[model samples]
Every structure is written in structure tokens, then in C-alpha cells.
Target: MKTYYDVQKFFRRFGIITYIGNREAEIELSLIELQSLKQEGVISDEDYYQCLGVLSYEKEMAIEKRSGKQ
Candidate 1:
């Protein structure tokens, strides 16, 4: 299973920075970045969904960690 760090590393490999703080801010920034990538044709809908999936998984892991459930 992939961990949050793995997801982060994957993004870093592509030169994309991942920010984690203030859930609202993170979501806002992620949406903006994803939109930019889509508009630039750098990623297709499928790729966008895949990336979003990874981000979502990482977010869930973070939540679990913070809640001391992991």
C-alpha cells in the first residue's frame, strides 16, 4: 500500500510541490493547480483523476494520523 510520503515523493518527482495545512487552503490550492494542468493540456481527465486519487488518499492518511488512528 502506498503511504502519504510516497504520494508526496511522486509529486516531487514531477516538480510539483505538495502543501499540507489548513484543509481548506490545501483543497483550494490543489484545485487551482489541477485546473492549471488541465488547461495547459499537461494532463488529461484520466490523469487528473488519478492524481486527485493520490492526493485524496494522502489527505485521508493525514487525517487518520492526526486522529491517532493509524
Candidate 2:
């Protein structure tokens, strides 16, 4: 997905909705779900990798923000 909203939509399409009341935790959960979909070959490589990159960046940014690094 190109954005976090798109990520949510992607998961929603598969009936997977994630929200743990924390951005980092939510992203962590999303990453796991996405990885599983990847392993199962349910998601296209392009979409999987794209979403992975965006989510990775997002998770990193969230961690950095929480640690006052950004």
C-alpha cells in the first residue's frame, strides 16, 4: 500500500482490522499479519513489498518519535 490508510484498507479487505490503541503496537501487529499474507502468497509481491517498506518506515518513525529521536 502507498499509505497507512491503504494498509488498513488492504487488511480490511481480508477482514483483518487492527488497532491496539498504540501506533507502534498497531503497526507491529499489522506487520505480522502482512508477513503471514506474504508467506501464504495471498498478496502480490509488489503490494507486499510496498506495504512492508511503508510500514517499516512508519514503525521506525514511530519508535524514533517515542524515543525523542525525531
Candidate 3:
């Protein structure tokens, strides 16, 4: 099993800032990051939802985003 620290490190390297918590926090953080990208015009709504699909997979897995969002 991956440790929380490992998950956090992966998120940091990919520029996705997520806090360790329950599934709700994971979903919220993913949404926040997705919204931030949309707000910055870095990703379209279609892309945001597509990415959210990947992030919302498991209950406790780490989520990552593509690197180029401003």
C-alpha cells in the first residue's frame, strides 16, 4: 500500500496540491484544482470533467494533473 507521504509527494511533483483526508477532501481538492485550471483558462470544461473522471476513481488514491496548467 502506498503511504500518505508517497501520495503527497506524487501530487507535489505534478503540481496538484491535495491534502490528506477522507474521500470528501479528495473530491473537493480535485474540484478545486480543476476549477482553478478552468478559471485560468488553461483547460476547457470538457477537459476539466474528463480529468475529474480520472481523479474521482478510488476513495483514497492520489490524484494528479497535467503539468502545464497556469
Best model number under lDDT: 2
lDDT per residue, candidate 3, 5-63, as tens digits?
44445446558877655655766676677677778887667766666555555333433
lDDT of each: 0.65, 0.92, 0.57
Which segments of model 1 are wrong by more than 4 Å? 1-15, 19-28, 39-41
TM-score, candidate 1, is: 0.54
Residue by residue across 4-66, what tens digits does model 1's lDDT show?
455445456558775766764564566567667778987767767766776677667668877
Candidate 3 stretches with Cα past 4 Å from truth are 1-14, 53-70
lDDT string, candidate 2, 14-64, tens digits: 999998899999999999999999999899999898989889989999999
RMSD of 1: 4.0
Model 2: residue 2 alpha-carbon error in angstroms: 2.1
Q: Give each model a TM-score.
A: 0.54, 0.92, 0.46
**Among all candidates shown, the one with the greatest TM-score:** 2
Error of 2 at 51 (Å): 0.7
**TM-score-best of 1 and 3:** 1
Residue ranges of candidate 2 with Cα displaced over 4 Å: none
